[model samples]
Target: MATTALFFLFAGFAIACAVSMVYHRNPLYSAISLVGVFIALSCIYITLAAPFIAAVQILIYAGAIMVLVVFVIMLLNLEDDKPLNRLRYLYAVGGGLGLILLVQTFFIFYAVMRAPKQTVDADVTVGKTLSIGTAMYTEYLLPVEIVGILLLMAVIGGVILARRLEQPKLELVVDNELERRGEGEIKDEFRIRL
Candidate 1:
């Protein structure tokens, strides 16, 4: 009973945070709200007897991914976006789409509530971390390796791009008493990137 209550609590909090994340104008606030949503989802996973998923939720999504997102936001130095008046039609269309989704969600929930019991075994090992890890190593090894290589390539590309973006600009520090054709007047030490 307590577990079920906790699950609902976290689920509700996650929903609320998701809404807040979408509603916020500031990117940083939205990112913070998304972190809250991730944590709440982690708690929900714990209540559902999926500690491995919960740990991943916290470690990967909340910890690593959110850190990257927040770092990028800070790096960009984002400001609150100004609301445009011409986008009202787009807002209306989005609201209509959201209404359709809400109705579809209700229908799906109703169908799910009246559905038959599971045909699969209750004591299945499919959800277990050990079983999943074993399957990844045995069956999905090639795909996993491919993904790892892709991620490595992405990281290398990102490093190259960052270095290129931080190229040093030379500034003239000419001495009044110095003669022409002097090469020591150029200073490349101070880098001002705005």
Candidate 2:
């Protein structure tokens, strides 16, 4: 099916980008990979027939968040950091075991808490933009506004940090050079250094 194929494609791309984001040494490259991951997530939403969610994923995650990250990277000029060191063998083994156990516990809890799907009216639009907007404004407006303000503050801070400082005064102007230098004394220091 088209949906299944798209789902797999997006999922693979998302995983690739996420891995690249983590492993890339360049901050700008990592930000770009993160944008790719966000876009792949948006595609997954589209495959699920949730166009509203897809749009938000594209607009907020890929657009706003990625831009902010890129801007911060540019502002900070952070290009010197090296890639992460490979983990030690014991640490890697332990982490793998811990991850497996965590996943197992999550599945067990999910299975225990699983609920039967209830039938709903067939007329409901699962991906309606208007409905999503209404819900967000009604239920999550405060949180959304707070996040927006935080982003604005971050942008302002970045701008302030990135601003260039005024050049320091080089030399004080002398109205009459005769006072500083003896009259008729040849100032020969202007010779070209070539």
Top model by TM-score, which number? 1
Number of clashing residue pairs in every model?
0, 0
Give me candidate 1's TM-score against the actual structure: 0.74
Instruction: Point out where model 2 deviates above 4 Å.
Output: 83-126, 137-194
Residue by residue across 65-102, what tens digits does model 2's lDDT show? 77978998999999656544765576679789979988
What are the lDDT scores of the predictions, listed in order?
0.81, 0.77
Q: List, residue by residue over 24-48, the lDDT tens digit for candidate 1.
A: 9999999999999999988876665
Error of 2 at 6 (Å): 1.0
lDDT of 1: 0.81
Off by over 4 Å in 1: 119-125, 165-194
